[model samples]
Target: YILRGWIEDRSADEARGLDRAGWATALTDPAVGTALEAVHDEPGRAWTVEELGARGGLSRSAFARRFTALVGMPPLTYLTWWRMTSAGRLLLSGDAPLSAVAQQVGYVSEFAFAKAFKREYGIAPGRYRRVENARAAS
Candidate 1:
């Protein structure tokens, strides 16, 4: 309920004219925020440090340093985390097959996708979906 309320409040804030930049004001570094936006916008893309750094107009080393300092992890680590998170969201909200979801989240192989998904969520993708569906129904 608390998480739901926070999502609602953030939606309300957007409705009241807060843009993405406004929403990201809590982040200290604009460059880090830029990198975040890039990753969120294209979690399926095969992103590299050089590419993300270029998006933020910083050199690779500087971008990695600032991103780790501000975001608490390296950029690629965050990218993989986001990919898994996006895949989980797709699982809950859509009827796409596991293979399709895996591809959409940047995995070419369903086995690899399932392995990573289990690593993150502690359940296989199908089981995770079933559990979340049951919870929602209840």
Candidate 2:
């Protein structure tokens, strides 16, 4: 419930409001569970180092180093992974056309979305959609 609330608020484009969500609550304190919760809450939005550092109350370089140590990857990489994961799930679940799905996930165009999706999943969106539909039929 808390996580879902955070997601909804973040997707509303209120990033500052989301800074206090369940996922972001443990960022500086570095709880693995809450760090992941933050990822779960806002999977599709981009995050900058300075922004997150300020939220965590640290310098940019310090946040970068500490986040790397705790999260094992930089914030941008983690954001991309999170974005792709959200896109993949939306692709699999929605009957909306790829373009619609692309827009839903913050891509400006279908071609770009398809390309990113393919790069992330090793298959084109149409092919993956077809496979997903076929599986659901059975």
Winner by TM-score: 1
Question: Clashes in each model (backbone N, CA, C under 3 Å)?
Answer: 0, 1
Kindly list the per-residue Cα lDDT of model 1 for residues 1-138, writing each as its tens digit.
323433644664455444445334415467877777777777888889998888779999998887876655688976787788788888999889999999998999999999999997789999999999999999
| lDDT (Cα, tens digit) per residue for candidate 2, span 1-138 | 444644554653342233343336344364334445565676544556776677656777887776666655676665665666677677777788888778766677889888988987789988998888889899
Model 2 misplaced regions, further than 4 Å? 1-39
Model 2 is weakest, by summed lDDT over 10 consecutive residues, at 13-22
lDDT of each: 0.77, 0.65
Output the lDDT of residue 26, model 2: 43
RMSD of each: 7.0, 8.8
RMSD (CA, angstroms), candidate 1: 7.0
TM-score of each: 0.79, 0.66
In model 2, pairs of residues that clash are 23-38
